[model samples]
Target: MVLAAEESQNEEPGPAAPVTMFGPDFPFPYDDWLRHPAGLGTIPSRWHGTEVAVVGGGIAGMVAAYELLRLGLRPVLYEAEEIGGRMRSVPFAEHPDVLAEMGAMRFPLAATTLFHYIDTVGLRTRHFPNPLDPHTSSTVIDLEGERYRARTPDELPNVFAEVADAWDKTLQEGAALSTMTQAIAHRDVPTIKSIWNQLVPRLDDQSFYGFLAASPAFTSFRHREIFGQIGFGTGGWDTDFPNSVLEILRIVYTEADADQRLIVGGSNQLPRGIWSHEPADSAHWPAGTSLAGLHGGRPRGAVTELRRTPEGIAVTDADGTRRTYPCVVFTGQHRLLLSTVRCDQSLLPRPHWTALERTHYMSSSKLFVLTDRPFWLDTDPETGEQVMGMTLTDRLPRGVYVFDDGPDRPGLMCLSYTWNDDSQKIAALDPEERLEVLLSALEDIYPSVDIRSHVIAGPVVTTWENEPRFMGAFRANLPGHYRYQRRLFTHFMQRDLPAEQRGLFLAGDDISWTGGFAEGAVTTALNAVWGVVRHLGGACHPDNPGPGDRYDELAPLELPEG
Candidate 1:
């Protein structure tokens, strides 16, 4: 488990302010906006029941729809499959109590906006057993056919410490990490913009690997290789090497990878809870009003076509039913606009269409299994160490996370979680085949332990690339894609857009600066909500201004197109 470098030893400090995902780009205080006493803006009395088409019932869509309802608008939600989208949690057939998190499993506390909904929905969270996390009993690092076990970072080999030190030096010298992190923690907009705006044009074209290679501290290829194999915070980051360095900086600078937590039951509960929850302050509706009740217990079918008409944006469902609404929020994967959904060319400007076409998504796969008990805790009599521990390897099973509910409850194990090329390698295999492949790899590391014997329920598997609704797991911008991302992230503030492109707004993790995290989904949802409200001739309370109200002053810095 690779760790971030410690703060400067000489720094004067009481307890520092907690870090939140306030942004290196578009640093708006979304958490404060959400918590404002003046609600999330209001719609005029005349537009109280006006219908707004919100495509996709994922976290972003659900958030947009739920907030829309509170603002007195009727959001007509359309979902292709289920409500939770990528926050999917699958229950074991035989052992119904245990779940296999097929989508997002862990979340960082910096995602405050997401936590707001989680708290509102009455969901609980516990420290996730990340590699080398304090909550984890032990961790095993297996690379190049060599295995080593450690209970903490200090227990690892000297080479591990060397690689960690090199990473620290690289960040401090190349990216000014400490200074920028302090500015972000303090919410100093001027300082953040001054530092990030300078870095954007300079680093936007650099890949994560390129950034590391250029650093003086990482001149050694062996050091770079080790750093990639065991990455900072979560797991191996070699798969993310091809992505833009700015993407990596966004993650680390915000502490998005540190001190992560998992929803008590499953991540799916947040979206599902929002779907069924009836807000006490919901305007223009009865006391018991909820999104579930509003839609008659189920959302409309999948949207097949989207076109713009003089009246409004028209949405056609799979059932051949057509609905036109004055405003529409599209929260699905942007790639769907080009593939699954038949969208009219005139709906958005040609440049925006180009942005959607150029969007890149990362492929991911996970294999999960249920066991009769937390057998991993059993000590090895000879070695005096646990029989098995959370494992990270360079082999097919890139990362293995152990989840022990309790002594009495069934145990869950993410046998394998791989990204990019690693995921593609096993994409063709069946569930049993995937399980066998993972077991075969783990067998080498824990030769004395028979992992297969304790299995209670089957190994469930998912390759996000094969899922038709979601072509890939999530978007990860590559080098030189900054302009494209800028177009999508700022699409919601559409006053400058042509009249034809005004009503249709885009909001999703793909449309946010920090994609693949729930904070991005929720923040972009709030952006879309603000867009919808403003489009329908509504305004936020003076005390609680929306993102759009502060857009001109706080928008992302633009780079040279030439």
Candidate 2:
């Protein structure tokens, strides 16, 4: 699930606290790394004036552009739409004080890389109401006409406890969750590979559904069904059941879905802040220069064509202006390059093109409405409890959230956030219809609460799958696609690319080992930054190892070829 945010009067909590997702041996020190001043590396004096093209304005593209600027290269960014890309924060049409996050709302505390930029920009954040989090005052799980509101795990039914235990046992005995996670925490790259390598070949071809069904821990099909309905971190894994088990493992093993928070105003601030921020130190530009300032207040129009030129790579924008950059980072959706724009066939290797074509992205839709107040806080006559807090159900509206901006501030509510086929069902519906359907679903769940009366404005709905700029919300790899994912994830390494494709690098959440997370996007962006630096004859700092420097040690496991 994407992170969500609301206005907060107080500053965000200090740097993320260490989590015990992988037990005591967990080794990666994200906080320590982020606190370090000397970044990835600096380029040599000879490469001071190189120009690079960042072909997307999302978090990935903006980070890549910022890092390139710091390394002494001039990065010209291109975006067809708004700069934030999927990190969009839409304000209520009637009430500007209220905000509806269209995409990528919730952020996990474990995403250290993403936090680095957030901290750098001094963005305020508050605890997100992820299910079961201590911060979540209440959570209502409705299934089959039954409603259970839990403030603590013990308050939940015994079956829920059994499901959690079963999942833990299965992961421990089957996938070495603790062992690999500990290795990952410590950055014990070799050990991580050793443990993860064994799991890949064994699980690569397996679906997420297969893992749960085959696990002896989940002997009863009912247990599996219950777990699927009320998933541990985010609610309901039914939509993701068909995806690769490796995808699920990455989220669980890395703790990417645990202990989450949201930027106070909006998550989009991270990208937009980075764009307008003047790095304290830079190679060519002065300390006061910003990416937006460099590009004359906004990025060039969307790229229409990309092709190889004698000198470098040429990018033709929607405005028909063409520019050649020595290095180009392709951060836009791969589908956009293949279908929307005219990409030169030779720009990427045939295998990579195949990977791009085969890449699978899950569709997601979110409907948000501005309400006069937090009407859900109203107590029931019989139960004397609030209608709901965060809700999860097997009904039409899978997930529901209530946002409070202070007692008097107008409230924001996400009526529903649906994924995959569920989202597709309402893709063609009008916003009013979508809101009506969601309100009806909510009414059924909370018959006593007059939610409709509190609504101050029309609903803001987004079907990301149908968005032209982004074909889907985020990448979710399918079974038998690890090899393809490997190719895309590793494309940032210049050593692996042919001469013609050397200057063109791929970086996005889609290109990372762990997708559907902001950290994955940041990691790949940093990788692309390193690749851009290398392509322009720059080198990683000996003190600050770049992605390539640690690729062999930290790279994903290589599966046996067919």
Question: What clash count does candidate 2 reach?
Answer: 9
Instruction: Give the candidate number with the greatest TM-score.
Output: 1
| Model 2: CA > 4 A from native | 1-37
Residues 1-562 of candidate 2: C-alpha lDDT, one tens digit per residue: 1111222222433443354222111123334433556766777787775778999999999998998888788888999999888899998878875678889888887787788899988899888887777878789999889999988789999999999999998888888876566555555544555566667788889999998888899898988888888898867888999999888888887787877888888888899999999988787777698888888898888999998999889999999999998889988887888889899988888988999999999999999988888777767778877777899999988999888977787888898999998999899999999988888888888887788899888689999888998889889999999999988888887686678877888999888767678787877787788787777677765766666776664566667666
Task: Tell me the lDDT of candidate 1.
Answer: 0.91
Worst 10 residues of 1 by lDDT: 1-10
lDDT of 1 by residue, 301-407 (tens): 99999989889999999999998999989999989999889999998889999999989999999999998899999999999999989999999998999898788
For all predicted structures, in order, the TM-scores are 0.97, 0.94
Relative to the unseen true structure, what is the C-alpha lDDT of residue 434 in candidate 1, on a scale of 0 to 100?
93
